[model samples]
Target: MDAITTPQNRFVREKDVEALPPPVATGGPVAWMRENLFSGPINTIATLLALYVVVTVVPPLYTYFIGNAVWTGTDGNACRDEVVGYRVGACWAFVWDKINFFVYGSYPADLRWRPNLFFLVFGVGIVWLLWLDAPKRGLAAIYFFLFVPVASYALLYGFPAIGLRTVGTGLWGGILVTIVVSAVGIVISLPLGVALALGRRSKLPIVRLVCVIFIEFIRGVPLITILFMANTMLPLFMSEGVTVDRLVRPLVGVALFASAYMAEVIRGGLQAIPKGQYEGAQSLGLSYPKMMYFIVLPQALRIVIPGIVNTFIGLFKDTTLVSIVGIFDLIRTVESARVDPVWSAPSVNYSGYAFAAIFYFLCCWGMSWYSMSVERRLAASEKR
Candidate 1:
């Protein structure tokens, strides 16, 4: 050690020692478990219990879903335990046979290609809009918000002027109905919700009161009630000869219901914004609309991205409620298909429901994963 002696400070040392490496067990799985799982008696006990439950539960689920699954069959007999000489798990053969019906419902087989094309366009629009680093995102927004909807309507409902056959909404069902309803709700809810949120916070008493009443009334009612009223009561208020399509009624109900909840979510984000933000925008001589568009709304929306995506996920799953109004959504189609006498077997019902569950889980999980990705991206941008 080289010592640097000062007249006022006699205890100073000049040399710096090299830093030592951490203990081998201090940076891996063992350290992680020690720090997180076994940090305390209660935590250690909980971890052990969770591990035991996983051990007990996962293997049986694995066996039922995979080991004993019937992969190929023409009908129910192919999945029957008696015919197979053992118990069975999933009946994927049934899913394979009914895949077309699950996708298209009673949509004419020739016209099925129309929905296929629509799905292709929808997929492209979604990818373009959702990919953060994509080029020309402003153009992507226009394509998604303006072009895709029009194109989808034309493709699905058809335009006879273009020699495409008119397909009634009554013929649409299954996954097609589910997607249409969810997409409409998701697309419509955000803008309408933002409007309502702003209105609720407006200085005008009339605007705030109207928004308050609307949001509360819609929020107070269950979605099923909204669908019922839309289905049975909404027509009574219309012009005597002006009939609303069955699908259109539920579409309106779902959109309105989702909008109310979305408004509340947005309002929460707005409330979280500091008052200084508003004042700063005003200091910049921005008009109310410009203030919101450029300064306030973006920050509020960014703060509430998770809530927005959660609402979307819930709305997507709630498309099943459309079935209560006699719509043939995915769950309705699955319920209808599973009762077929031709495919009757003990495993058929289980398989059909499991298939529905898997589809829903996958869709919801995708939304959740995308939401997390967006949140991470936004967070990174904020840190920068």
Candidate 2:
């Protein structure tokens, strides 16, 4: 007990070892470039090629879009390179002149305030629902899903009793039509798709069979075919004197088309869920609906957020297809305005198309970004 038996008693350091600094050559930009860009001959060459392309392309694009762009002009004459005796790029004046048409289509200029208010309400609802920390989310959902629709309809179509004049769907065009179509498709698709997915997975034969048929049938055809059928064939099938709103037919078609695709995405997620999860929910004495709602679906949906967001992005871009059925969406308005004799110029076409591209890009990017944010938040929660 008096003699130490530990290894520490057997040996002792006579002096401390000198500490050396890490190699400077291995810690800076040079090291990073060697590791990432020039790690191998193939990578080095690829990096050089990429740099060349960007150097050659980006500045010219910048010059065209911004450097040589015509910012303020009244008509085609103002943007004409021949008249100006210089090279011109984008004719932004045309876009500015048609901005109202782009936003509201043929919506009466006097009643445009209604659409502005509609946009404000829609924006508020979107912000409220998307802000995860915001108060009263349940009410926000109600406002977005129920009140927004009713109010949007009344505001756009007008209520005579309230002194608003009636405006036909035929007058609707541009971003207004695009938003309506995209919103309807997105709002209707998710729940409908969930039901279809659940039905396809049901033990009951008839429910599963019907869901399969619907999903397969819709997925088999191009979206254009669905729009045509909805626009033309749907009316023939309707009973005499039963008039369907022109805008609504395409809305139904887009919603159904998106729902079919969304069902497949959700079904993929549902299949990814472990069998043990379902069994565990059942073991807890939960009913089928409660098990799915509280246990199965939440996990499945979280696992497939990317797939859901991808479907949403596709649907958002696909709204442009409605223009074929005489619904003047954003692109359609651009096309119409570009050919106008008033604003007609060499650059007008390019500018109009660029504007359309930018609009679509921003909208799609916003959705993609939001989905990624939600995914990151969910991942953090899982870690905790």
Candidate 3:
């Protein structure tokens, strides 16, 4: 009793207790590896396999790229030696030499700046459109609809007073052709797609049947065959002496192909919208167009943005197939560069291909990121 009273007489200081050890550092690298890579036998095996791959593949790649490996400007002796076990890494020098040809194709040397300027303007316009929220979308629409196409056409195929000589589409090459083809296809297909989607869902049987047949017929064939038909058979559809530009042929093919797929994607969106939305609009005496424009489409489009973007990406990549018809897209441009006598090396081919791959990866990745951002923004807006 006496000892208990004495203990009660003293007060403990604030610093008497030590602070708890910091979280046991459970989220650090060591803990992360333990949890993710070495958590169990299966994880351990996976980690080891990944480690094996990194070790086996990465060092050689690093050395091949960064080391003192010669890839181009080899003599006949060296070329023969390479074929007989003197292996070399990628020859980027070839790309350096032939980059202009790849980028501009046969664009007149003096007029190359015209395409470059258009490319810059278009890129800026796209970035501007994408970056701003609640932008003057109507103005942006006008710029897209009225200004950009006319400006691009004028810049690439110059009119007088621009101080730039005219360059025809025939001379377009590299990623430029790919970008143009894809952009035009996207712009044209969207409205056509919406129309086709509406038509397919129309109460009118004739309209629906026609839409169905067009969609199914286009979707049934491979894109390559469609492109071949465009390249070969499209001319016959025109009047005598009415020759279409080669660039126009691929554009037509891409538009038709993309519209079919986009129609299906839009139809999926339309289907996902509740029937009550339609009934509600009808009850309000809203016409079909008004209902779609105001109520049904907005919701449906929000839901299907991902599908639409995925289709866009697919169409973008498919534009490369135009190369088969002799249009010099990015791939074809690189191939053309590879055949250059000055840059003729096996390593150069790989380098050019790698460059094209990087370009494509950047574009596709940007588009995917934009799509995801839009999806998130729409979702948050809905929640609000």
TM-score of each: 0.92, 0.92, 0.83
Most lDDT-accurate candidate:
1
Clashing residue pairs found in predicted model 1: none
Ten-residue region with minimum lDDT total, candidate 3: 72-81
Model 3 deviation from the true structure expressed as Cα RMSD, one decimal place: 5.5
Error of 1 at 189 (Å): 0.7
Which residues of candidate 1, in runs, are more than 4 Å off?
A: 1-22, 25-36
Give a tens-digit lDDT track for model 2, residues 1-384: 435767666677799989998766987899999999999999999999999999999998888889988899888998999987889998888899999999899999999999999899889988998999999999999999999999998999999988988999999999999998998899999999999999999999999999999999999999999999999888888899998899999999999999999999999999999999999999999999999999999998888899999999999999999999889899999988898998878999999999898999999999999999999999999899
Clashes of each: 0, 0, 0
Task: Give the distance in Å from residue 264's predicted Cα in candidate 3 to where it truly belongs.
Answer: 0.5
Model 3 bad stretches (over 4 Å): 1-56, 65-87, 132-134, 160-164
Overall local distance difference test of candidate 2: 0.93
Local distance difference test, each candidate: 0.93, 0.93, 0.83
Candidate 3's displacement at residue 263, Å, is: 0.7
**Model 3 local distance difference test score:** 0.83
Which is superior by lDDT, 1 or 2? 1
Q: Point out where model 2 deviates above 4 Å.
A: 1-19, 22-47
Models, CA RMSD each: 3.4, 3.1, 5.5
Give the candidate number with the greatest TM-score. 1
